[model samples]
Target: MSTVTSEIPAVEATQFQHTPYYCEENVYLLCKTLCENGVADATGSDLFVVFISNEKKQVPLWHQKASTRADGIVLWDYHVICVQRKKESDAEPLVWDLDSTLPFPSPLASYVNETIQPSFQLFAEYQRYFRIVHAPLFFKHFASDRRHMKEPDGSWIAQPPPYQPIVSQDGILHNLSEYNAMSGADSLSTMDPDTVGAAVSQKLGVVVSHTQLEELFTKLP
Candidate 1:
């Protein structure tokens, strides 16, 4: 694991306000804000939107503030966060999970160890899979109609974000499912390293196993 150092100053977590239970929208706003503020360009960091889920849609995450248990574990259908990969070789990547109780921007290693818990064994149904999307392409191609938060009868499962639903630059109305769906067979270990970047950018994204999560950004060119 890469050690956390003070060389990089922390970004205040409270600087942005996030809507509860709206992780995908929260991360979308985060990436937009960071780009508008020039943080991505100034730091030479590439941003990625990571969706955590599985074929069964029952992914377990720890250290989530939404957990009712003492261990801060939550069984979520899906969850999203923003990861920033610095261009500098010595600087560790950072995870920005607005819903987490951990540091605002936790180091990738610490987030994986504490929140992801890749070392912990799990049943086949609960094993985690990650869909990693390059932020620039995601920003351009992503759209959400908020249909996922509704009941079959049209009642809301949860309150919706105050802002209007996000639409893709090319006028795609809804493609949330395209990004959220993860199959067990789409592990990064199976892909050629040279094609990973192209695949992620040209398509929706790449789905990787829990064990392959941390090394993903490092391996991408």
Candidate 2:
């Protein structure tokens, strides 16, 4: 038997914030396959099916919620997976394939130019996920768990600080304009962190602990 050279990380249940959407669930599995086996076809590919919410236009018809008003949205930030395909070669039998499965309906359907720009930008950024396997890139999306923080004097802050990106994946660093355009975010002149710690402090207030933030910042490029 051939000895395996490396091990892969599995999708932790906590990585997902919302209840796993069908697309999210599929992509999660696809990511695992890609991490382990590289890239392949639908039947043979071993990558998690990554899902990125289409920020442009309304959600796709197929991705829409059926009965309940359940945030029947299709497009999201982004999702991606790596697949393995067999090649006739003298050495290794498999090679990696990056397949982007857009949640947008009819993906090629024409739409108003204005709404489409943002979604396409989001799609481009999602491509960066592959860099995670080779090098770390700083991609920060923040959500605060208010339950975990307490002010030293015992008062609660309404909102946490804005999130900051930390470098954990390989890719070109994102420019301010790129970040703003992809996230549809306003100028962060006043709030974004030049350092991730500042960004966390801005959201969590001066009193909140930043032990984790401190550790992540130590690895910055």
Q: How many residue pairs clash in each candidate?
A: 0, 39
Q: Identify the leading candidate in terms of lDDT.
A: 1
lDDT of each: 0.82, 0.26
Clashing pairs in 1: none
For candidate 1, lDDT tens digit of each residue in 35-154?
Answer: 767767532237888999999999999999999988899999999998887666467888999889888788899899999887789998899998988887887889988998899999
Output the lDDT of residue 5, model 1: 66
User: Which run of 10 residues does model 2 get worst, by summed lDDT?
Assistant: 129-138
lDDT string, candidate 2, 91-153, tens digits: 222211122122211111221121223244333323211111110011222112333234777
Candidate 1 lDDT score at position 80:
97
Candidate 1 at residue 90, lDDT? Answer: 67
TM-scores for all candidates? 0.91, 0.23
Model 1, residue 201: displacement in angstroms?
A: 2.3
